[model samples]
Every structure is written in C-alpha cells, then in structure tokens.
Target: MDFDQVRLHLNAYKENDQVIDAAKYLLYSFDLEHENFAGFGLRKAIPNLFLLITEGELGEPQKVMIPPNLFDFDLNLVLNVIAHEMLHVRQKSSINTVEDKNEREFQAYYEMLFHKVFPKIPNASDFHKKIFADKAFEYYRRMGENSELQQKYAAQKKEIEQLISILL
Candidate 1:
C-alpha cells in the first residue's frame, strides 16, 4: 500500500476509527536518532524487534528510514512498518515496566504480522521478511534448537500472555 492507501486504511479502520484524529504518535524516520533501534514505541508493545545497532547507521532517504543496508521492501511492508510505529502512539502509560513495554511491542507486532505476507519484495533484501519471521516466532509460540534462546522466548511469551490477560 502506498501512502494514500495507508492513510485511507488508517482513516477507515473500525477499531481505530479515531486514528486520524486521535493518533498521538510522531512517525519519524530511522535517521533522526530515536529510542527504537528499528522503530520505537512507548506502550501497547510486543515480543521481538530488530535492534540493528551497528556503527555508521545512515538515514534512508524517506520520511521513515528503511535502513539502507537492511530492507527496501514494497508499499505494504513499508506501510505496515509505519502503522507499527503508529500503534505505539498511545496515551501516556507507565511504560517503564518491562511488561508494559512487551505488551506494547506485542500488540504492534501482532498488528504488523496480521498484514504481512512472505513474498520477496522487489529489489529489497529479506530484511522485511526476516522482521516478520522474528515476530512470527514470538507470536506463534515457536520453539527452536537453541535451549537458551528457547528458554528466553518461553519466558517472554509467558509474560506477554500474562500481561495480555491482565489488560483484557
């Protein structure tokens, strides 16, 4: 989806009917140096986020930075990425809590996952797909060979679910 399409969708979203008016987040590029390594948020968050913290992080030439060395994906992925950040724009909450942060990331990632497809975006690396994949692994309660990673994943999932239940 292009900018207009995303705007239209966001404008018409049933759950987020007031998104256009009530949206309280600033959509910024990866360049300007913010808290999020890929994209940042306050609360209503989730499980996994790619934190590319290498030296010499250059800004991609767009409103939202695409991390030139990372993915150059298509309109939907880009829009979803934007939407992910938008989802982070919520009323002031005590995000200092780890659970709150995970909840925020979890919700944003779930929304992003809901809109993603696993096709090769033209001229873009697998970075977009990889991002989705990482989120998927977290969201779907996936298991892997690495015991330590699995344990950490399991713990995070437990906390995420616990937080969701409390929030609901």
Candidate 2:
C-alpha cells in the first residue's frame, strides 16, 4: 500500500499515538511500502521488533513492535529505531544464514545512520556509532576468528567506518 494508506492503518491502532506518529513519519519520509506489514503497535517485554519468519511463516502477517520505552527517547531517535525495525520487516525474508542476518542488521543500522531523510539528529551519529561498536560489532567480533562470518563482519565494519569518516 501507499504512504497514506499506511498512515491510516497505523492511525487505526490508536493505542500508541506517539508511536503511530513516528511510524507515519518514517513511512512518508522514506516512501516505504506498507503492503507487507500487518500493523504497528506497542509490545511489552520483547525488544522493539518486527514479527519474523521464525515466529511463523514469511507469508503470515507481520507486525512492528514498538518498545514502550521509546517514549522516553528523542523523537529523532525513536523515528530512526522505528525506521530500522521497519527495514527489518521489509527484509525479513532475506535472512537464511547467520551472515545474512548480520548483513540485514548492518544494512538497517546503516540506513538508520545515513538515510538522509531528515536533517541530522543531534548526536544520532554518535549514538549509531556506539550501537555498532558496543553491540553489533562486538557480537560479530565474538564469532570464530578468520571464519567467513568474521570476515564478512570485518568487511562490513570497515565499510561502515570508512563511510562514516567521509559522511560524518
């Protein structure tokens, strides 16, 4: 579906109004499609997410889960995270291997950092860097050394760093 239809779908939830607004902004600003999404809503306990194939089938309706804590963060940060999860939702089908999973995450985080939709969010670049250095990169670092996974991880890490040097 188109952006307006997606906004209407999100508005119909009416449970997390702020979240719906953020989702709407991301959808409109990025021109992301809504046909694959079942809906968007708050989900407790689970981390912010999009329902994945592992939870069911790729053909099953998928929902984006917004962590309630997002209300405590910056609007820009919230938008970026929601955008990241939405990218996950869009790419949920491409994850068939651990390497593919890492690549998807890298892509999402990369988009989150540098999609050029909105103007730069104050400190958002720093925040994205920390997420990569502390979590995502760390996870990849722990993988078996010199293995294909580690190699792919290293390559992505270098690529992101190089891009960041040029962009930020």
Best TM-score goes to which candidate?
Answer: 2
Residue-level lDDT of model 1, residues 28-145, one tens digit each, is 3212123423342222212333222112222321122223212223444544555554444331122332233444455556555443322121222245544554574564443445
User: Could you tell me how far off, in angstroms, the CA of residue 47 lies in candidate 2 after the best superposition?
Assistant: 14
Residue pairs with backbone overlap in model 2 = none
lDDT of each: 0.38, 0.54
Query: What are the per-residue Cα lDDT tens digits for candidate 2 across 39-136?
Result: 66666634453321212245454577665454444444655666666666666644432235666566666566556433332235575555644455
Model 1: how far residue 24 lies from native, Å: 13
Q: Any runs in candidate 2 off by more than 4 Å, and if so which?
A: 1-18, 45-59, 68-72, 94-100, 116-125, 162-168
Alpha-carbon deviation at 130 in model 2, angstroms: 2.1
Instruction: Tell how far residue 99 is off in model 1, in angstroms.
Output: 6.8
Models 1 onward score TM values of 0.31, 0.59
